[model samples]
Target: RPAYIGERVVTPRTPADPTADSDKVVWSQTVSLLLGALCEKSWDTEKV
Candidate 1:
């Protein structure tokens, strides 16, 4: 009988942030930017 194929192995490994535990901070920053754009509150506003 012939040998069967096994699971594939990856090389070089995938890039990642080992220190990150969750995406809470990322989502928070995204939401903040969205709110700012919706309210037209940017750093270059001259209507202050």
Candidate 2:
């Protein structure tokens, strides 16, 4: 794969066993992204 200028690749290794700590981090990210999406939707609706 050719790398483009300023392009970066990130790889995150998964744990052999899913632990509570890792799950919590993933869940928190999910929640934050969901909230951001919801907020954007509401803001767009309000602007309409």
Candidate 3:
């Protein structure tokens, strides 16, 4: 049902900046470790 489902190609209006998303990230090893442990207990490895 989506436009790209067939042979249509989707292109962004502007070139993507690789660092653009990283700029918004809150880098914290503490949070990463907490989430990693939580994910291990919950068996949701995809989130980590």
Which candidate should be chosen as best, given TM-score against the real structure?
2
Q: Tens-digit lDDT track for model 2 on 1-48?
A: 886322321222444545754665676678779999999999999999
List where candidate 2 sits over 4 angstroms from the true fold: 1-18
> In candidate 1, which residue pairs clash?
none
lDDT of 1 by residue, 1-48 (tens): 653221111111333642342344455567768988867866557576
Ranking by lDDT: 2, 3, 1
Top lDDT: which candidate number?
Answer: 2
lDDT of 3: 0.48
Residue ranges of candidate 3 with Cα displaced over 4 Å: 1-27, 44-48
Q: On residues 1-48, what C-alpha lDDT tens digit does candidate 3 reach at each position?
A: 555411221232333753533332333445667889987978865655
Clash counts for the predictions, in order: 0, 0, 0
Local error of candidate 2 at residue 22 (angstroms): 0.6
Model 1: which ten-residue window has the lowest total lDDT? 4-13
User: Which residue pairs in candidate 2 collide?
Assistant: none
How many clashing residue pairs, candidate 1? 0
TM-score of 1: 0.39
Cα TM-score of candidate 2: 0.60
Model 3 residue 10 lDDT score: 27
